[model samples]
Target chain A: MNLHEYQAKELFARYGLPVLPGQVAQTPEEARDIAAALGGTVVIKAQVLVGGRGKAGGVKLAHGPDEAYDRARDILALTIKGLPVRKVLVARAAEIARELYLAILLDRSRKLPLIMLSAAGGVDIEEVARTAPHRIVRRHIPLEGLRPYQARALLKPLFREGSQLTQAADILMKLWRAYSEGDCSLAEINPLAVTPEGKVLALDAKVILDDNADVRHREWEIWRDPDEETLGQRVAREKGLSYVKLDGDIGCVVNGAGLAMATMDLIKHYGGEPANFLDIGGSSNPEKVTAALRIITGESRVRAILFNIFGGITRCDDVANGIVQSLKQSPLPIPLVIRLTGTNEEQARKILSENGLSATTSMDEGVRAVIAKAQEVTA
Target chain B: MSIFIDKSTRLVVQGITGRDGAFHTGQMVAYGTKVVAGVTPGKGGEKLQGVPVFDGVAEAVAATRANASVIYVPAVFAADAIFEAADAGVGLIVCITEGLPVRDTLAAYHHVAALRSRNGTGRPRLVGPNCPGLISPGLSKVGILPGHICKPGPVGVVSRSGTLTYEVVQQLTHAGLGQSTCLGIGGDPVIGTNFIDALEAFAADPRTEGIVLIGEIGGSDEEEAAQFIKRHVRKPVVAFIAGQTAPPGKRMGHAGAIISGGTGTAAEKMAAFEAVGVPVANIPSEIPSLMAEAMGRRRPRSNRAAAGKARRARAASRPRPAARDRARPAAKRARARARKPARRAVARAAGGRGRR
Candidate 1:
């Protein structure tokens, strides 16, 4: 749900905010073409979702088209934070008189959108929060959203000139529109720069859309970065399961988000590392379990697969049936341990036993068994 | 006995006639919940599972005097459904719908808050936009929680996750500890109820002798709850937090279960609880014993042993289908019971530390 700098800028531009003209280029030639068109000193930024791109040498400033092409080539060849640079944003660089930070994000504690403004910008906000806590000012937006007067009041400390304050407030209002209308969890402008000519421009943009609001904004589907998704994640998403890959040997499939996390924690507590976190969700549709197994088993690093199901709305029998049916289709090479309890648990145990498999009802017992089995496989 | 719903809860189902709504409504009715009405805008004047259906929440409330409403409507209409339920004067609103936009939840939450300020006496309590709802064991079931996993007793349970609540509740039940009420406050970033709200209720309720709080990596609700427990709650409280191994910035299934910007980590929450003198359980199964220790700590020195004996007796009297269903021999069960003291000793040793 994270948008690249270019994408965020594009969204910002659509709201008539003062964003530098930028173009995304996948190749050096395209980068040259964009740099030539902009006809000024340009910044070539790697289009990756992770932070610290500049520190990783993925961002470079170029004086002309030739330099822009060379910078883009270097960036495109680099892998920053394990993600290969697939695209670069070629934008006209700004001449900043001063830099400021502006953002509106959903504050979980307040259960409302919060506008955060700071005099410090172009660096990690968290670092600023830790070191100079007084620099940042935060105001919670009401259900009606960020009002124009509220935006001006929030920005007044950062801006000295009345015209500049009004201009910045207008931009803040536009950013709020983009955040609320586009259903964004976060919309940030780092280094809201005031040029020597006294015009304000957003040097960088980062926007994270709320995935839960996808129903309202189906058009946002085009913005999804397929490159960011692992094959397992993609398949899991298609199967209506939540799966996150981790570097471990014990693959865990559990019901509910909290239980999935708890299952992972228990695996680690028992001295075993979990390869993935998979939640089949509340409805115990047998197909989801089958899909979950297929995804987990697809990871060759997994030495053992553990199923921890505590059924509530989810019936344990459906999960057992899914496991049985999956094993029948293609047997697992890795060891499988299941701990089933709660609703329809007896029926689930019966189904597993009929298939020459048995499940423990105790989470501790099951976690211990799986860790032992995984260790055996390693040994 | 319960903090929220009990035998007096007259429930109404919103989006009744829909698949999930109809299905869970039938389950609630089967669990002895007094489901007085159903609300479906177009499918009114019909009976679903012998419950009368009405055109809207207002009509349903007027006709049946349904004091509580559970919504299973789709995410698009969920916010309006909350507004309707609140406007219709339902005192307790439990929304089971998931994937509601945060904006909608915020609006609904503020609307309810505004109503609370305007009309302080009968303002409604909203449980969740994405939760399994709550159950008062043997008295009433409101949402989708499986009632059989619970039993009527002195313990009160509140959690952020659904099946995780069941996991801990089943452990408590197997340990011969039943619950007064078990509630899931939902895992969305914005929810109607929070840990402090539920903890305060449990602290005030006389029937709730001990409290088990199941929290995960998310907002500082658990940390705030820990503070609330330290300042307000005198009851024995045991806490368990999930997502100890979860990496930062990844939503671990639940939309809200993410460790963002070096905050909302499980370790932080656990530390908060430990600082507040709440026993933090390392695993879900360890919660019942931790609850026992917490409760035992509050009693007089001589009564501690007597309380332990009473808890063991209660556990022994319960039909332990969980152990028996493993198909283990009787001798193995006896050996497992014999090893309980050793496990308890280990748990006690690790009690001072939030994490090993």
Candidate 2:
């Protein structure tokens, strides 16, 4: 649910924050038109979902329309951190006499939205945190919005007492409004630059929306980035499966989120590494099992697959049938280990046995058997 | 010895007649829970699993006097269901629905907490928004935990994961150890009843001689529980945490099961448990023996039916990965304690019960 920089800036501008006017251009011709209209030096930023765009040579400055088109062409052809640049943002370049950092984020440890401001900007905050810890100022905003005085206090040391300070504080408040109203998990402006003309503007925008809060925020759908989602994730989402791929050799398919976690933990404990975290949820649809195996076996890193089902409301027979059906379509190269118990366990075992496969009832035994089989395959 | 419920405990089922509601309701009734009433708007007169249905929480409460409510409502209306149950004077509410929006949960938590403060008595204690509820095994059951896997015993179990809780409880039952009460506090980002709340109840319950805490990579609830054990708990405690190899920034299946800002890792949580004098188990199967060690006794030999499987599980046990406790080797010390088997549970029960 991460919003691209242009989209985040749009929300920022909508909330009355000072963000430079920008246009998204998918082609070099559009970039030329946007650059010509801005009339001054424009910044061409690659619109990819990854950070470190400057480090990756995706962001460049252009003085005129021709230069803007050339820069956009170069960026659009480049892939930064495994994501191809699809579009470029042409924005009016701002004159910066000083750069400051600001962000409002939900700190899980504090259970509060933290307002952070730093005198140092235009660099990784992790680096700043490591080098000089005292340069940053942070305050927790409890359910209530960040107050004016609190915002001023965090920004006071970064700027002198003047219109710049007042303007920065105002923008911070507006940013808070955008953050809460938009149900954002993170709202950040890396460089709140102070121009020579004494105007403070948000130079870069980063906003991460909370996916769980989408029940209320229907207007944010246009901000979804399909490239950010892996193919496995997209397929799982469409099939109503909750899956997050990992890097290991043992693949897991379990019912219930908690069970999926424990299955992974048990795999690690038994001297095996889990390749992914996949939860089919409470439904015992055979089709979900089929799709889950397809997703897991599709991974090149997976050496063996494990299915741990403690059927409560989920019927074991459906899962067994799904396993048999999937194997019939195309037999998986990796070995499969399944542990089925509870609610029609006998029927599930009979189905698996009839399909020339067997299931274990003990979780420890199942994990051990899978690890051994996976090891044999690797050897 | 059970902490939450027993035979006489009355229950109300919210979202009754729905898919999950009807299915789990049948399980609860079969498990001997006193399911007195159900609530589902427009399905008031319908009978579900022979339980009387009402339109709202207030009507259901007035007619049946259900002191506890377990909600199976979807995430959209789940928060209101909590408010409705609390407003109707139910003392205990268990929410089993997952995927509840965090904003809605925050509002529900505050509303329930505020009502308790204003009334000054009979405050409702909420279990979870994404949890498997609690079971006082062999007496009464609420929520979705399978009843047959557990047996009544002196061990009290509290966990954040439903399946891991079942895995550990089943292992304990297989090893001839029974739980006085087992509860899954849930894995959501913001849950109502934390590990501390469950630990506090277990500490006060006379039936619980030892406790097992199963935590995953998540919030600082496990660390707080370790601290609470140091200050107040007298019962022998054993702990296990999942997601040891979980990569940073990955969601790891649960909403709250992510390592954020270099904290909430399983290694840190295991260290916290060690610092507070509680034994830690590396895997779920080790939980029963660790709890036995904490209780200063040997695990009673399992029945003949499970003997072969138990032997195979023992044979499959392997050395765990690199110990995260670089200097202390705190978990190894816990294994050492298992060999000595000091009778702390007997001494504590005889030591005038250590003043609350």
Candidate 3:
């Protein structure tokens, strides 16, 4: 659900924030055209989902149209942190006299939105937090609302001159408004520079919209990349199960995420690796379990499968039926360890036992058996 | 003796009209939980499994005086269902629905917090908006979670982890200790009640003698709870932190299971618990003994021996590459150094053999 830099900046512009003029270029020709239209120094940046693009040589500068085209072509050709750049952003470069950092993010401990600002800019905030946390001034926005005076007070120390402080305060207030109204989890202006012309422009803009609020924001949906999804994740999404693929070899199908993770961890603890994360959720229907198993078995790395269901609303017998059906539907070659508990557990055990699959009530034994079985195959 | 539900706890099932809801509700009521009423909006004055079904939580509360609620509502309407239960003044709200939008949960959490602040009566306590709910083994069970794995005893259980709670309780049951109260606090990022809140309640319960806190990676909630336990908790507590060597930078089962940038990790949580004199266990099998030792029923055992054995077992259990990860890298280095001259000699001998 992460937006590209151009999309974030687009939202920023809509919020009335001062962002450098930019154009999203899907091709080198479009980038050259954009650079020519801007008629000034341009910054070409790779449009990747991950951060550290600049550090990974995904960003470059050009003085003229040809140079801009060359830079964009280079960035589009490059891979930043393993993600290839299919597009590049051509932005007019701003004159920087002094750089500053500004961001507003949710502070979980305080249960409020916290504004972080620093005179130092254009560096990873984590490193800044680790090295000199005191340099960063934080102000928690009260539920009552953010006041312009408070914004002015925060900016007052950063600028000795009154005019620069006033201008910075106005921009900060606008940023806070965007953060609150735009449903952003995070909005940052790195290298929020004061130009030689005595005006402030956001040299770099980053915005992370809350995924939960995305339903209400249709404009934000356009920024979503459909190709970003993993095959298992796509299948899980379609099947209505919360599935996140992991790197381990032991495929886990459980009733809950907490339990699913615990099952995966248990496998790891017992000397097995989890192939994927699959949660059948509260409604442990036969279809959901079947889909989950299909997704797990799709993973070639998975040598064994672990079925852990704590069936509260999900009956153990129903889950057992699902497992039996999955086994019947596909002649799965991997070893299976089933731990069924809660309501109808006896019935479930009966079903499994009838199918010649001995279910274990003991999780330790189940984990041990699964790990042992996986080990047998890998060996 | 249980912190929440017990034998006499009145229970009502929400979304009882749904197929899954009716099935689990029937199962739960059959399992001996006092089935007072059921709630499905616009379906009041009906009955499911011989239990009265009310149109809404308020009507259900008014008719049956049902103090406890188990929600099986869809994720879309889960927030409204929770608020309905809260508004109806239910003593305990256990939501079994997962995949609630983060905003919906935030609103629900905020509403509950606001309710708590406004009431001044400490009226209803929220368990989960996404959790599997609570179960009082041998007494009352509300959740759809498999109930047979647990047995009523003195070991108070509190966990952010749901699937493993059954395993923990199973181990405890096998070790001959029944659970006083077992709670799955939900694995959602912004949950209603946390480990410390449940632990504090467990600490106050006279029937409870010990606690087993099942912790996972992500967020500082566990570390904070561990600190609180050190400062305030009186009951003997055993800790088993899951995902010790979980691969970093990957979101596993829950949104909260990812360990990135060194913040809520198993190792860190274990260290925090250990600093507070709480016995930390590495494996699920080790939890029962740790709990026994904490309760003064067994002697403290060496974790080193268990670790060594687990390492060797794990190495033997995994693929060759993974087995190498568990191998002594220092030993590998030393062997590589010793083989340097041998490799040179072999190369020279290979040259001679080729010449011949």
Q: Which numbered prediction scores highest in lDDT against the true structure?
A: 1
B204 Cα displacement, candidate 3 (Å): 0.8
Q: In candidate 1, what are the lDDT values of residues B336-356, reduced to their tens digit?
A: 867775344434543543212
Worst 10 residues of 1 chain B by lDDT: B347-356
Interface RMSD of each: 0.9, 2.0, 2.9
- Candidate 1 achieves a global lDDT of 0.89
Best model per DockQ: 1
Error of 2 at B311 (Å): 34
Best by TM-score: 1
Query: Which residue runs does candidate 2 get wrong by more than 4 Å?
Result: A25-30, A73-87, A107-111, A127-136, A144-162, B297-356
List the candidate numbers ranked by DockQ, top first.
Answer: 1, 2, 3
Model 3 chain B: worst 10 consecutive residues (lDDT sum): B347-356
Docking class for model 2 is acceptable
The true-versus-predicted C-alpha distance at residue A91 of model 3, in Å, is 1.8
Using alpha carbons, what is the TM-score of model 1? 0.92
Candidate 2 per-residue lDDT, tens place, B1-356, comes to 78877887899999988998998899899889999999999999889889999999999989998999999998889999999999999988999998787767877877787787888863788889889999999999999998888998889999988877877888787766788999988888788888888898898998898899999997798998899999999788999988887777678777888876567899999999999878888877677767765675323345434765876776568433334344457787677657643333323332422211
